[model samples]
Target chain A: MLHRGRIQAQGEDLEESESWAADTPPTWQEGIAMIDKLENKIPKKEADLRREAFEKARSFVTQAGENGGVNAVVQKTIMVKDSKEARVDIEVRKGKAFI
Target chain B: MVQHLFKDFLKNKRIYAENVGYWQSIVSELFAPTQIKAEAYLQTTFANGEPFLDGNPIFHFVVKKLNKAVRIVQEVAESDKLEITAWISNTELDEMEINELVIVLQLSEESKTIALDLIRTWILNDETVKNTKLKIKEINLTEEILAH
Candidate 1:
């Protein structure tokens, strides 16, 4: 599965490559139109996968937000240990502490 | 730097040290999520009657607002990325809030250093400051399991 910025260890690359090929630098309006077309063209399964990924990202953030006080929630990265496991790293704004 | 800027601004305005805590409390409270409305609690003056410091007051106001919004999201979602589409203000208010905050908070050397460091961390961490985007990647499955 081709994830946000990385190629997942799966046969997802073929479809992802095709989508990437279809993508071109677009003007503002063209960009909007392109997004519309892409949204329409994407397979339901692929769309579901993307939505799941987005939700996962959102969940990590939500958890950080709940726990973090004034600190801002940053990024979370998951390192896959194997097909059934991974490690999640979360970054948050520590803010400047004045002594 | 914020402290210095605030101190200098206060000095210039001839505000008394007795009032410093009050102002700080105001700033901090404004940033609190529970503070839905922040009315001017009190406005007393020093004997000198120097014009209120040129910038810090308003700057504090805006920062407090942003902080409040951030706090609100943090309280509600716990771990969700926040994309604040609209708040109580428009683009003009947003721009002014950010600009004033940068200028006022950057005025004092200490405040500048602190603000810069905070800003650097915010950027490096991919966290939003005033009006930017933020993304949180998922935790690895192993870490989640371990935590449990």
Candidate 2:
């Protein structure tokens, strides 16, 4: 689901060893410290592009989810934001229900 | 001059009747939009407590432009009434979007009721809201206080 919020895992299914997230989510101070550390890694221009990509991805997900069901796979990668030709093809699992 | 006085009284009544008809037309003109039906998109997606799916079309218009989703969502969680609390989310929105939404919300008593129900359901059922501490507010839009 394309959700707008600080992304966080909800369930306990993620194994601590496999997951990059801290077992106990960081405090506000720690989160800020982490962002500060990673600030140099992300370019300012790329941030805008990334934000646009996220929004586009969200829209793609929403339309696909509604017309078909939840089961979908990311098919290809393209960089430009305005490509109407850029489509995320959805494979609807008709007989199987995920919920 | 009793006849003259009665004629003057009749003239005054005629003026009053004309003014009443004119004002009644004006009032109906003002309220005409409210009688029109809600947009089909809104009716299908949001009305009647229909499930607010992840990629609902409304999200494309409202939430996509949200520079202040966290703050707005938090305020909604704390609102005494969901729609009233949502009024503040307008601050984050451009004027055009707000105007469009206002028309929808004010269209009819039925639209307002449906919208309020949708807001209440959407907030309570939101997946990201794991914080049990965040209290669910009732439908009271009169008092305006920003919580958080």
Candidate 3:
């Protein structure tokens, strides 16, 4: 019978244990710290994107669609789709279900 | 002279009328892509609420927020009235396109509702419709914020 204690006693087990240590994700507290680091840069990034989006949206609404007249939007519907192929693929796979 | 004044009034009325309908459609659907299902995602994967904001797909290539998309999600959890502000644009590979997006939602409802408001704010702020009144009493979803 292969005893579990015998494996742990082996010198090779030391290397296996080291590898296991390397595989661990950050600790919960460390993870929170990582999240904080990632989050710190988020606002500025998103703000820039927001500004660009506003410009794009405004241009589309005015120059591209001016013929419809402002009142023309009454009948229009809003459908959001990613222009990037990768993003579109993600949406298609996820089917708009969050997570 | 009276005819000229009438024409001016009609033009103004037409602009406001058009905006009114656009706002209605916006509020009706409200937070779309981030439907009620988002709450589940937040609870499970995204820092319990801190999903970065910039990665949202409401904007395509010009803005990428993949690794940092949880900030906005976390902000909503921390507060009640936070604004997202993004664009919902679509074009035919730099050809024909449409970028009309208007949204209104009660931030205090759910994650989906909050996301809807944030993204909608960006769409609603389009310069073309910026001058129009944003409220009509016909269907007051929230207070009187409806775009007129």
Candidate 4:
């Protein structure tokens, strides 16, 4: 036992901690409210991109609906990529209604 | 004959279906770019559990139709990013007769806050869709609503 106690650790704990330290109890409701508030701030540019992608998807579905046949299952899938290169995929189909 | 029925179904329900799915998908795709997980649910319930009226079915066919539409939209949203997955569901609320749709998304700690803020803004600012309102509620990890 070579005087290990005399040689103490010197470096600080720098690794990122996964746990969050809060003084008070974290309520589920509060966490949800916080998330809601954050989502509401999505940039206008991003919103517009999403809207455009949605419209394109709608158009595809409409066209498929327009051309329908008996016992026919119309299926259409489309992919939209935004300026950031994020891709969105949409798939639609119609057939016998089920409960 | 079947084609005619579907055509009529789509024509009568087109605008509603389009608006509902479009708005939900737009939000889904936007968040997808950030590798956040997002999903939308379109549900219908009959008032007082009454039978389907001549004007509207007890369970309006549109809800299911829109679910499929949203699925397609999610598919497109995923092409841009590998971090998002979207799901849609239909639930029958006993003795209730109102059509309800909800879009719920899961994101990283950083992205979660951003998404919540955007939804709050939309709820306060956007009123173009008639009789539609946006609400944000928490999902308990232990009590998951995604399966439903």
Candidate 5:
């Protein structure tokens, strides 16, 4: 399916637009990486900090699962500062990294 | 830029509905069964402004029949340019690599073309970035599912 929309904000609207661009949510890819990091962290001198991190990561994973696994809740709209345009094409074999 | 404006946009139900409606319309034509659901939530961000978990997805498109799927993500790079980043992946248990010739042979090229056109229209029709050229900024495979 194809989707389309134009975000045209003026004086006041521009403020809101910029905000949207700044804090756009992270994609599921990023979320999973975070969960993995939190779950596999070593318990050492920073036990308290580690626990806090665990709670934060657990909340994220729980949230993603509740919404529908990472696959379902994976979409993001962000704004960056760059001016390069190029189309990327990837090939995947059945059981390997990008090839 | 301002905190209140950002807060207002996040809470704006109208714009949220518009986003959901637009994606639903396009995804309906692309997949069978036409069962698409979208929900939005407020995610937390780090001091560096990176998004973290704590919210729901605004729109979810499920591909049941095809092993390959093309996911479109919208990003407004700066204020004038709209950068289109997409992920093309197959529902397999393997990691993929990138080269010159990719999924064009397996996945439906027709669908890819339609997706690009849709993004083009989004930029062309926008009042803010009108007359700007549309280009596909990046296409990559979805990150590998890590063991957690």
Candidate 6:
């Protein structure tokens, strides 16, 4: 499957491991490092455009709220992975967290 | 810039939804799934006022109020009246803008430990300057997430 910048072994491009140095397991860390180096070489606009995509797909946030009748997000967060729609919510009843 | 996007969102959520693929590509560059972690425990600050885990904090706070016959889909739900500080980010092609805002979220609920745990991974984890490598650039919150 297509993941990150590289095609999986199943795709048209080379498998990630093969694309790397003859040695080494070719971890994601290497992928990121390679990206960092490549970023410097790309045009500013292109580099920035690339960065923006990653930022949007991944968001880290928390919310906390107290002194509420039922819903006060004192400190909490809502993360919806691999989707564009919103997916963070909580329902508390009398000091308890439940599904 | 973030505020401007917020206004735009208010005008049309489909604005971004309209061109999801294009928008996704832009945001894709800034984060990788590995960098995007979901583990909350009552605290979170993606960007320190200083970049990459600096003690200094720059927060994008926003507040949203409940509006017009609010409703949701859930078997059980309770709500609280909340005043909030929201933070958000918007990817406009080559430009990435982040901002902090303040708004009120009306119609909320009070929670206890047991129920809170149910949604812990999604919201209540704590990650900040002292913990993760995530930086605090700018935060732009949306009303859709806050509206009661």
Measured against the native two-chain assembly using Cα atoms, what DockQ does each of the candidate structures obtain, in the order listed? 0.02, 0.02, 0.02, 0.02, 0.06, 0.04
Q: Name model 3 segments beyond 4 Å from true.
A: A1-99, B1-55, B58-76, B84-94, B100-148
TM-score of the second chain in each model? 0.20, 0.18, 0.23, 0.25, 0.35, 0.20
lDDT of 6 at A98: 10
Q: Give the range of the ten consecutive residues with the poorest summed lDDT in model 6 chain B.
A: B66-75
Scored by lDDT, model 4 comes in at 0.27
Candidate 4 residue-wise lDDT, A38-77, digit = tens: 2234444443444554454334323323333111111122
Name the top lDDT candidate.
5
lDDT by residue (B37-73, candidate 4, tens digit) is: 3333222221123211111111112223222222222
What level of docking quality does candidate 6 show? incorrect
Per-residue C-alpha lDDT of model 5 across residues B98-143, encoded as one tens digit per residue: 1110111111233334453543333222211222222222231111
- Candidates' C-alpha lDDT: 0.27, 0.25, 0.24, 0.27, 0.29, 0.23
Give a tens-digit lDDT track for model 3, residues B18-124: 43344334444653544221111111112223311211221211112111111121111222332222223231111223332323222233324444444344433
Residue A30 error, candidate 5, Å: 16
TM-score of each model, paired residue for residue: 0.20, 0.20, 0.19, 0.20, 0.31, 0.18
Tens digits of lDDT, candidate 6, B76-123: 111232222222222111122212111112112321111122112212
lDDT of 5 at B112: 36
Q: Using TM-score as the measure, name the better of candidate 2 and candidate 6.
A: 2
Could you give candidate 2's per-residue lDDT for residues A1-99 as a string of tens digits? 221112111111210111113223223333233333332234444434345433443443344334432221111111223321121111111111111
Q: Is the docking of candidate 3 incorrect, acceptable, medium or high quality?
A: incorrect
Error of 1 at B116 (Å): 20
On a 0 to 100 scale, what is the lDDT of residue B114 in model 4?
Answer: 34
Q: Is candidate 2 or candidate 6 better by DockQ?
A: 6
RMSD of 1: 20.1
Top candidate (DockQ): 5
**Superposed Cα deviation of residue B16, candidate 4 (Å):** 30
Q: List the residue pairs that clash in candidate 2.
A: none
RMSD of every candidate to native, in Å, equals 20.1, 23.0, 22.8, 24.2, 17.5, 21.3
